[model samples]
Each structure stands twice: as C-alpha cells, then as structure tokens.
Target: MSLDTQSPGLLAEPQAVQATADGGTRLALRGDLLDFTHQPEWGAIESDAVRFREDHWLLIEDGRIVGAQPGSLAPDASWTRHDHRGRLILPGFIDTHVHSPQLDVIASHGTELLDWLNTYTFPAEKRYANLVEAETGAARFADALLAHGTTSAVVFPTVHKVSADALFAAARERGMRLITGKVLMDRHSPDGLRDEAPDFGARDCVDLIDRWHGVDRLAYAVTVRFAPTSSPGQLAMAGQLCTSMPGLYMQTHLAENRAEVKWVHELFPDARSYLDVYERAGLLNARAVFAHGIWLDDDDRALLRDSRAQIAHSPSSNLFLGSGLFNWRAADEANVRVSIATDVGGGTSLSLQRTIADAYKVQALQGERLTAWRGLHAATLGAAAGLSLNEEIGSLSEGCTADVCVWDWTQGSVAQRRHELARNLHERVFAWLTLSDERNLVTAYVRGIARYER
Candidate 1:
C-alpha cells in the first residue's frame, strides 16, 4: 500500500473481501500476541503497559492491523490462518541507525572510528558508485534485515545519490518503511566517494528529496555524515535542507569515539562542545538524530534534552570499535530520547537481538542495568518515536502498519526452558532478548506481506 506522507492514514481500507496492494494475502495470525502500550519509563511494565494476549488472533487487512482479540472472542475463521500457536508474536524490530552500504564492511578489523572509516568504510562505499553494485548490495541488505525480523529502519546510504536511490527502490519494492538519505560529505575523504557542497552535494540532496521522499513508505533523511567529514559550507546546506523541508529528518554521527570527539572539538574550535558543532549549523532539534552519544557529558545531555534531539544508542558498534559504553540510565535521567540500533559494518551484526544483547553487556560494564523491557521498547516503539514514525509503524495497534514478527520459543532446549520458566511476561521477553537469535524467527511480516519465514 502507498503511504502518503501528508495523510499516511489515507491508505484505502480493504473491502470485506480482504486484499492488499501487492495482491499478497492478509495476515490472520493466531498466537501469543505481544505489543507495547507506552514507554516503559512511565512505570512498571505490567499488564496495563504491555499487551500480552494468550491464544489471540491478530487480523491484518490492506497492510494495517484491523483487530486483535483473545481466543474466546476471536472472530470465526474466514481467511487463511497462519497458526503460530505456542509462539510469541510481536511488532517487527526497527533499526534507528544503520549503514546500508556498510553491509560488506561488517567485522573489518583493527581500526578505530576515523581511521576505520578511511581504511574500510570509505573504500567499501566507493563501490556504490557503480549502480549495479549498489543495487545488488541493496537487495542483499534488504534480505538481511528481514531475515533478522527488522521490518523498518533508518538507514544511511553512501555519499553517492544512486546508493540511496538503489536502496530506496529495493525497500519500496519490498513494501518496507525505510528512512534514508544520500550522505553529504564535501571534504576530508577519498576521491570517488566525496561530493562538493552548495552546488553539487546540496543540490543532489534536494533532487533526491524530491525524487524519493514520501513515495510509498519511504522518507528522506538529510544525512551529513558528521561534522568532521562535512565542511562548514556543506553543513550549512544540510541545515538549510532541514529547515526548508518540514518533515525531513537529520541523522549523523556524534561523540562516538574519544579521538573522534576530541577531533570534532579541534575541527570546530569555536563551538562550545561536540554537540555545539551541529548546533552551530542549526542542526539540533526534534527532527534531528545523533547516533552513538557515548562520550556525551552532562552539558551535552542537557543540550540534547533541551533541543529535543534523539540519540541512536548503537551498543554493538561501540563495542566493536572500542568506542565506549553508552550510559543509558544517565541519558534517560537527563530526559534525552534514546533508541537502539545495529550500526552495521562498524557494528558486528544486523540483528537487533544481538545489538540488545551487546547493549546489556555494555551497560553492565559501566555499572548500570539495562532492563529487558526498556531495551525491547528501544528497538521497537522507542526507535520509531525517535524518528517521529511511531504513529505509523512501531506498534501493532489498530491502523498501524502490519510489520510483525513471530518468534518460536520452542526452537532450542534453552528456549524451551526459558519459555517454561518465564512466570511473568517481562521474564519471557528478557529471555528472548538474551537467548533468542534470528533462528527463532518463525516468520516476519512487513506491510501484511511475509518477507521472511523459517
């Protein structure tokens, strides 16, 4: 179904016959249903906060969830029922920060942030200059996300505009909710991967925005790779794009590694702090997303909170690059929005489960506890809220997109025990987050279409 950004709710409802734009069958899932109700931070994640229905029916029509009910009151079978009885069905995962071009660069060894980019990232991204390569990578990347049960993502393509075009086309074909943009980098980089500002990089961004933004479920992000890579002029143009376009999202890296943070301070010497660089460019606000806020201090936290900017907490990437631990508790206490992500390439894997597992370890090393409910929320609704897309894709609420995942807790012996021993819903979620992998995914749905099944 085409989702018009102006009126996303206008997707025509299916008639009583139940059909989808792709001519795919609607989802008639019968299982142990699960979905978030509110941010876990408000209070305890008890029955009132999370919807957990035993032996329930979740109906999806025309790419939207039409109804959810317990077995006793479940509608009589009319359409095909995909029985997931004895499994856990929840909203499909969403990755708030990821590099679609970096899929091949994942697990590249022996480099920190900046050097890693120069040695591995920039070189790998240079391949996307070939549209065929970018499209091929896009196809593989799309499958990888679905295989891991991630139905939606906020992706960063290469500096090449064709990279964003290729990935956007691939995602559009699959009917996934994706936010991506061409990286605006004018300086401090390799030859083939760089683009000039004001005339070239800036204009290409506008053209891309017009070409892809609001087309189907796809949206555009005004991605300025980072302050260090982008010249003052390039950043100014990025800020202009953000201001000119009402709903355009802004994403970039920030305070990820100590050296990178120090360099940002040196590069933008007049700025107050690392976050100040973006602030100076008029790029700090609710629509902006800064990834890897690992080295942020109290002042930076306050700045982020006041500006209403969001942070994409990429635990796996932080660990892989030896960047630093993210202080989740401190960020929350500071009222800075935090969401989880798999910062692939720099991140070890694309699996949100693996990302959360690493997040648990990262927080533990810092003498902080990352609750399972909070982590799960960060991967789903919290991530969507960070991008201001929660109303459309985060939950299984009525009228929300039918992006869902069914997990088989009976996959392994350990899973079986976790299922048997989980007395509370929180415990069950915790076990799944800790032990479950992509292998446990029985099926995954994006816009009422099964994208992955095993």
Candidate 2:
C-alpha cells in the first residue's frame, strides 16, 4: 500500500505506532523537503556525503521521525501532512557556545580579547543580579536564538544564580534544548561581579544542578570564566562538582588571545601548559566544550584529543575581536570534535549563516576550504556530536526530535538570481551559504511545534 492511501485519521492521532506497508499505513511530508542527510559532509577530512531529495515524503509521529522516502507515501496509513512545497528544510542549527546575559552587549566596540572583556563584557554581565532584568534578557536571548534557526545552545549566564534560572525558565517555556550555568568567578573581577566565596559559589552551582539540570530539555553546565579569573581554590571546587555530577557539561574559554595565553603561563608557572591548568583540575573530558581554541600547540592538541573534549569554534567572534584565525585543519588532524557557533555578544551576528560565512573566511586564511555541506553539518550534526546530543536533535533521522528549519531558498533578489543560475544541489547549497542569513529562515520548529515563522 502506498502512504498516500493511508487515511488522514492515523496521522492526526498523537500515539506513535509502527505501520506495516502491506497494512496500508504510510507517512508523508506535504512539501519540498531538503533533508540535510541528502549530502552528508562528515568533517574536514571526510569526503562530500550530503544528499538532496525533491518531492519527498517524511513520516513523523509523536515528534520522532518514523520513515522518509522519495516520491510517494504509504497506502492505507493515517498521517499528518504538512504542506511546505516551496520551502527548504534542514536540521535545526546548534550554537555550542553563547553568552545569554551578554545579549545586550553584543556589537559593542572592543579592543583585543582581554581588554574587551574588562571594558565591555564584565561590566555588561554585572547587571544580571536583578531577576526582572535577567528574565527580560533571557527571553530576548531565547527569542533571538529561535528567530535565527537555533533550536539548541550551550549558554553562559552571568555569575548570578538568578541569571541562570532566568535562562532555564525561559527555555523551559519554549521547549528548547538548552544548556547553561552560572558564571563562577571568585577573584580578579569587579567588586560587584565576584562571588562572595568560592565555596558558596560552588554550593550555588550544586544547588542549580539539582534544581535545573535535566528539567525538561534543560541541562546544567559547570562554568568557569577561565583560569585567569578563577583561583586554584575555585578551579578545584569546580573540578569536584564535575566529579560529583558525572554527566554535567564543563564550558570555559581557552587560548583565544596572546595576552590570555601569556597570563595563563604567569598564573600557573608549575603547569606545563595552559590546558594543563584545567587538566590538573579534573575538568578535561568528553563532556567539556572549550570555546575559542585558537592558539594551541601540539601538546595542547594532543592532550585535548586524548581527553576527547570538544571545541566550539567561534569564527565570527575571533575575527571581530582580532583574536586570531582558528586552525581548522589542525583541530581536524588531531581528531578533535569541532562545532561552529555564534558566540554573541562577542560574535557580531546571531545568524548562523553569517557564522558559516565567517568560518569559510577563517578556513581560507589557513589555505583550506569549508564546504557548504560541511558548514551545515558543523552547525547541526557535528555540533550535536560535540554536545553528545546526536541521538536526540542533530539530524532528522528516525527517532530524533522534530526540530527543523524551513528556508526560503529564494528569499531575496540576489538569492533568487543565484538559485536560477544554480544547476545542482551542491551549487544551490553553496549559493545559500554565501548569500543567505537569518532572513532566509521561513520557519523554526522545536519538537514538532512551530516556534517562529517569518
């Protein structure tokens, strides 16, 4: 039996059941579906593997994909049909590193890395103490992320526990897959920004884990503002928290600027390298997501590879701050899991498309090319792998959550002209990469529900 023969009643029901082909049950997608799986680009070393299918039928039930095929539907099966023929569909983008409270400070004038933090980042982050302000910021942050086709993010809130709570609360209301935590810093910060005591800060982090971790789609992270601002005592406590909470994620900046690297050397003279500071603190592991690994040596790369920690490549921020170009080839050669992200407010744009564009430039500077398929994968499946969330949200594979993005491939005149001239799926993908932005995202869906539509 063909899927089209299946009655609409079955598709309308919420209960998910396996449908036998002979029993006349089939599922269908009612529009032009651009399944990212069409052409899979595994990574920097992998060959082109992305695929594209036209006039496709995707069978989803209970927020999980049950089946997908080209050109037809199962017969005698009931299916929920969504007509999106003129749209482009892809997996929801995953932003691996972002500062939720820093939403207000994005695009502020900045010097270099350390100076930028002291001048703009720290002072802006200090305002999260008020629950009302935090709540407002969280909501705006969530809205901006969703509007830009980001269904999941690993966010950094301010040092205030209320800030983390605000972000988690906002995420819960939107059914977003979010990871966030309070910034833990006990020294070297402005007076108002410092936590009263290291132990007290650690206790708050522990309490937050119990309260917010695993709540709905929310996950808690053990966040440190890098080794410079955190003393040995605080780092040790954070490491203890990681040990106690085996599955929690660890996020912090790493080797982004020359000054920061020099400071790490001065701060931990006994440590072999900057990465060693975190390694000795028991914070290096597969669950850890280190942002901006731009200045790493062979030793640092090797240690990171051995520990299986992932890197969140923020190309836009790196370029905007004049930090340095990230060695994509080096990270790939070391077998490190790499994911692309818009590290906004430091990252000038919220659009993942812009981030991808920046990544291409960053790679070009290193005499490499970042293909469109690979860029999309990095923003989706690659990111999901980095976050250990591949089974849940990365692809539109069977049993994955139905978080998806619908793009208007010809959203603008330039894009339309390019689309008309493009001959194949790969060319079209490249064109979109070069020309598209958040403006091309027609709709954003989370867990089978539409959250934003333009």
**lDDT of model 1, residue 421:** 88
* lDDT, model 1, position 274: 86
Q: Per-residue lDDT for 107-128 in model 2, tens only? A: 8884888888889988888888
TM-score of candidate 2 relative to the true fold:
0.90
Stretches > 4 Å off in candidate 1 = 1-26, 42-47, 197-200
- Candidate 1 Cα deviation (angstroms), residue 59: 1.1
| Residues 10-110, model 1: lDDT tens digits | 22222233444566556588899877777886325564557678898898877789888776665554555677788888899999999998888899989
Candidate 2, position 353, lDDT: 87
lDDT of each: 0.84, 0.81
